[model samples]
Target chain A: MRVVVPFAAETPKTRLESVLTPAERSAFARAMLADVLRAVVEAGHEPTVVSTAPLDLAGLELPGEVAASASVTADDRPLTEAVNARLPGGDAETTTDEPAPVAVVMADLALATPDALERLLTSTADVAVAPGRGSGTNALVVRHPEFRVDYHGTSYLDHRETAREIGATLETVDSFRLATDVDEPADLVEVIVHGRESNRAPACLREFGFALDERDGRVDIVRNEDCAAE
Target chain B: MRVVVPFAAETPKTRLESVLTPAERSAFARAMLADVLRAVVEAGHEPTVVSTAPLDLAGLELPGEVAASASVTADDRPLTEAVNARLPGGDAETTTDEPAPVAVVMADLALATPDALERLLTSTADVAVAPGRGSGTNALVVRHPEFRVDYHGTSYLDHRETAREIGATLETVDSFRLATDVDEPADLVEVIVHGRESNRAPACLREFGFALDERDGRVDIVRNEDCAAE
Candidate 1:
């Protein structure tokens, strides 16, 4: 089973700009990507990283097998267009094989485990999607030849419509790990709270000197000052 | 869109017998059944209640439209066998149809609303399921010709296996309202806590003189003696 993990190389996760600097955001995005990739690889499948631009994987802390086998492809198209092009018959420029099942696991699903990925991959449907908390689609496995994706304005709803229109069966996977993606500054706390269950995202945040603070009944992630760059 | 709302008519919800007497438990079960039937009617589908024994809906206090439209069927077989018998080919004694979509929404999903039911009905999959929190399936819409249900241990997992074996596409609806069912004593607190959203289950509980007590950081449902057994 081939699985693709999409990572935005340029200005990734801009919502975290309030708390993370440009360099910090990039590092954190890579960390999240590594976390997602490890889950996919451990689920018994090699993963391909689809990035908006070139990614430097050197010294990028990943499991040995993952670092050795993972591949990257640079593409500048928008998410919807790029992903649709990956689906068979969506684009003659990219898709060059017979129609078959292609799985897309987004890089921002920092909390996903091998079990969650396994569930999504095993669906015997034309299209199987995991919904994002905010009505976006976090991941999908598309087997229908006519189904392509549209990522604007609640892509989860759009995918449903697309599947129905093409006479393809659609399935949704109810999963917390796949649904919780690191998008906003507030979402960082989830990584810390749910991190103790062997999640790598929390360790990534801690490596950058971030700590969880609970004061006045409010939980927040605060960065340590002593670890500032020299 | 014929929807079946299954109710166990005899000695129902024995798990709550500790908190509620036999009569009170029957009333509460009827209340929950009414709640589910109302949602189905509001979703623009007429529902049939497949009960284990005869159901007397005389004083069932349902909305006018639901009371006028909902119908019930008596079947003494186990849940899985009874439901399959209703399915097209599962039994020669029952179904005589050429296979079409049939939806089964358990009467215990007290939190379900028209919107949640509509989501399950709108799925384009061969089998669309809304899972229960404890590895059970609360509701499902089956369109596959060869698919049927098994209500034994972990029916959610069983249904998935059944679908895979029959090569039928499966979809899971990730809905909080559909996922929460009022089966255990603690589940009553959910209807009370989230009840303000026009849930009939909480109202049913209130009519039976039950209230939530959070005296010690631990929340519980305690029956009020003043309004009980008058």
Candidate 2:
């Protein structure tokens, strides 16, 4: 099976701008992408980073054994179209009689682990999906050639319906790490709180001098005074 | 209209026991109940505390003019049955020619504001429901006598079905304060973060030595040494 990590390389993580500068957002996005790539590599899958803009993969610390590739989408299309183009029956040039299943993983899943990716990729169903909170399709393994993705309003529900229409056996994987995508300021709190053990994203957040603190009677991200002075 | 606050006073806030002792849970539960009651009173409504055990309203600091009552269920019935009994066509006996609408509000809405409650009570639908973050019905306004309450699994969906069965128009009120209910340890983070601006629940949590802190890469409630000594 082939894995594709869809990344919004250009103007990424707009929601996180409230807490992070543009440079910090770009660096954080790359750190999260690296974290996801490391997990995919650890799961014994060679992942291709499908980016919006040309990405410099030389700086990324991927697993030594795993051969990772980077490709830029021809156009600035919706995530669904960009990811769909890389699938078996998609527009990408390929010469295999039987196209292998393609798994599309979101780049923002900073908490995802190798075990979680292995579980998603190993599902026997024609189409396996990991649903995110608030009706989102976080990651999907599309084994069926005819199955396409639609990331518009409540895409998880839409994907389920599409799978049924194509007579594909749909399997839903409930994973906490895969379900979490860093989108809002509230989400940063989760990354800071849970990503401490992980080296990539949590380390990046700490290096950026961000810490969770209760300010004005609410939980918010506060800059460490010691780090700020440095 | 009369407002009814359903409280699980016996084992209130079992989820918070990880951070709070049994005594602290009881105190926190009472503080949240008081906050909800204060909102109901400010909304120009008299609220009754429908609890598992008989409650002492004299201890609660309610508004001066708002007269609050307390009632205990004969048995540990499901929340549906308990709240249903307080409705117009419900088990509660009525002598007037027309039965006034009754609003059922959950006791754990720590951030509930007066304006939010007023919006719910003033809704013109035969049955109005405030949907919680998960599958919970935080509050409901039943103006139609035929309308009933169902607090089963995913009760908000069940309530909508029940309203349709009764041919009553259902209005869904979306209020951040009304939508938030303290259920899990993670929920306490929201309370500590958002409730700081509010005096009632935030003050009570702070007074109990509870504060948000990151431990082992997760946001958790921790006690201050000075406050613990107190």
Best by DockQ: 1
Task: Output the worst ten-in-a-row residue range by lDDT, candidate 1 chain A.
Answer: A88-97
lDDT of 1 by residue, B180-199 (tens): 77778877876765443565
Candidate 2, residue A99: CA error in Å? 2.1
lDDT of 2 by residue, B114-222 (tens): 8778879999999998876434588999988888776755566678889999899998765556777887776675577546365567787788777766544334566
Q: Which interface RMSD values do the candidates have, in the order shown?
A: 15.5, 15.2
* Model 2 lDDT tens row, A1-230: 67888988889999887777788888889889888887787888777888877777766665565434443343467788888887778887385678789999999988788877887999989999987654568899998889999886556767989999989999876555676789877777657654527547888888878876654324567786566422
Q: Worst ten-residue run, lDDT, model 2 chain A?
A: A66-75
The model with the greatest lDDT is 1
> Which parts of model 1 are misplaced by more than 4 Å?
A1-230, B92-97
Badly placed stretches (over 4 Å) of model 2 are A66-75, A214-219, A225-230, B1-230
List model 1 lDDT by residue over A1-230, tens digit each: 77878889989988888777788888888888888888888888888888899887654677798877788888888887778877756663354567767888999988787877888999999999987643568899998888888776557766888899989999877665677677888678767654435556687788778877655434567889776444
Clashing pairs in 1: A171-B171
lDDT of 1 at B131: 76
